[model samples]
Target: MEKAKVYYTDMHTTFRENLLQKIQRLMKSAGIETIDFDKKYVAIKIHFGEPGNLAYLRPNYAKAVADVIKSLGGRPFLTDCNTLYVGRRKNALDHIDAAYENGYSPFSTGCHVIIADGLKGTDEAYVPVPDGEYVKEAKIGRAIMDADIVISLNHFKGHEATGFGGAIKNLGMGCGSRAGKMEMHNAGKPYVKESKCIGCGSCIRNCAHSAITITDKKASINTDKCLGCGRCVGVCPVDAIKTLNDESNDILNCKMAEYTAAVIRNRPNFHISLVIDVSPYCDCHAENDTPIVPDVGMFASFDPVALDRACADAVNNQPVTPGSRLDISEHIHGDHFCDSHPETNWKTQLSHAEKLGLGTQEYELIKI
Candidate 1:
């Protein structure tokens, strides 16, 4: 495959052109206007940081993207699916609240914020992945699938499980509904936490597969019968049901690539990643440690895989921040993300994505 074009611009800004304007310029240079967005619903998929994590992208950046979309005759909305974990973003209501708390309100982003997966994290579209080896069908958030165009506005950073979080991470794992996330993160079915079970038959009632049963004032999940749809995890009022999270990191990356393919397949999609913050863990954590590397810059591309590769290369090229996590750790791999997260190989995601014809890892970085 030929090298894809990945446009880039550093964070350095002059008084005349602020960071927001710079991002807009970057997007334009990246050919965002090429997409015919006439009165179309465009989903700007992003991670509205966990309530207490301050590293997520700012609302101003979202506004810049949304404004560009609107100027191109599109209706844009900032969106993300509810997280599978028990956190501020576990459900739509709480997820919206978390977005709002993190300053992602419409008033700030110049667009509405939609929890893609709906109230209970159950509203989903089972998109078939024809080339998938691990996931035959990806359960994506309904709101995301309903959009006419998809845009990933990602906060590129370190990830404990995936080495780094970029366009693929933002679109694949980020777009997955609760069940889809469960599928990516778990190799096995969910189980009931006996201590948390209140004898509430909520799980039993909601289990379409009859995988759950209440006994002795406690809930138990039958692994043989469970489909791992994660509905029981959502309906359990007491949060008794929990996923095993047994999927190996490599398999998790492959599943994530398949999920991303399911998401952007046969759709007009674009990707932008800001390689700042460079946190050593996912934004799903309520707290973020200091950035492991100095702020790099912003990147945009039509090819998600190429975009991620570019961003990763940029981060790896930067010097490690003093006193940060990467500074103290042993840099055995000579790669920033791998040095930060020894357990994960981010290349698996890009290679699998390329193998599935999502996009090529080879890219031409066009600096603005």
Candidate 2:
């Protein structure tokens, strides 16, 4: 495969042109307009920051992308699947509320926010992964799968598990339904936390495999009967049930790459990642630490893999911010993501993505 084109723009803005305008220019330069969006449903996939974690991309960037889609005669909506873990975005109602509270309302982004998987994170489309190894069929959120086009508006940052959250991570793990996410993150079934369970019987009712049973007003999952659908993880009103998260980092990255492949396989997709507020952890966490590095900039590409590669390279080339997490860490693995997360090797995701025919890791960076 030839080198993929990844366009980039610095964070330097003057009086006339601000960062927002720069993003618009960057997307156009990256060929976002080339995609025919006439009356099609465009899913602008984004992470509406978990309330209190301010590292997430602002609604302004989403609006810029949505506005461009609208101009091309497309119907666009900002969308994301419910998170598998316990958080404000675990269900559609709370997810929407959190999104609105975080200022991603239709009033802010010029489009509606749809929780991709339905009310309880169970609604999904079983998408077959082409040439998949770890995953055969990916359980993706129904709304995201129903879209005519997928545009990932990603916030690039370091991650604890996958090493970094970029285009691949955004589309793969971010788009999975509750069951799908569990499959990628864990090798074992979920166990109920008795301290948090209120004996609501919500989990027992939602489990189709008859894997859950209640004893003494608490829930217990029968691991033998459990299929690990993760529905019980979402239905617990008090956030009692939890995933085992026993997958190794390499396996986790590979599974995420497969999931990413499942998401964009046969769809028209575009990717953009903003490398600002380079947090050491994901926005899923309620607290965000200081940036590990100074703000890099915005990047866009038709190829998600190349886009991520370019962003990761850009961060690796930059000087670490003083007093940040990167500065505090003593180990230098020659890669910032790996250095920040010593247990993880970020290359696994890109290499696996390349093997899956997603996009080449080699990219021609065009600075605009």
The per-residue C-alpha lDDT of model 1 at residue 360 equals 92
How big is the positional error of residue 208 in model 1, measured in Å on the Cα after superposition?
1.4
> Candidate 1, residues 1-368: lDDT per residue as tens digits?
89999999998989899999999999999999999999999999999999889898989999999999999999999999988888899899999999999999989888999999899888999999988999999999999999999999999999999999999999999999988899999988888889888996888888898887777998888888987888987777777788878989999999999999999999899999999898999999999999999999999999999999998888888998999999999767999889998989999999999999998989999999
TM-score of each: 0.98, 0.97
Off by more than 4 A, model 1: none
Error of 2 at 273 (Å): 0.9
TM-score of 2: 0.97
- Alpha-carbon deviation at 78 in model 1, angstroms: 0.9
Clashes of 1: 0
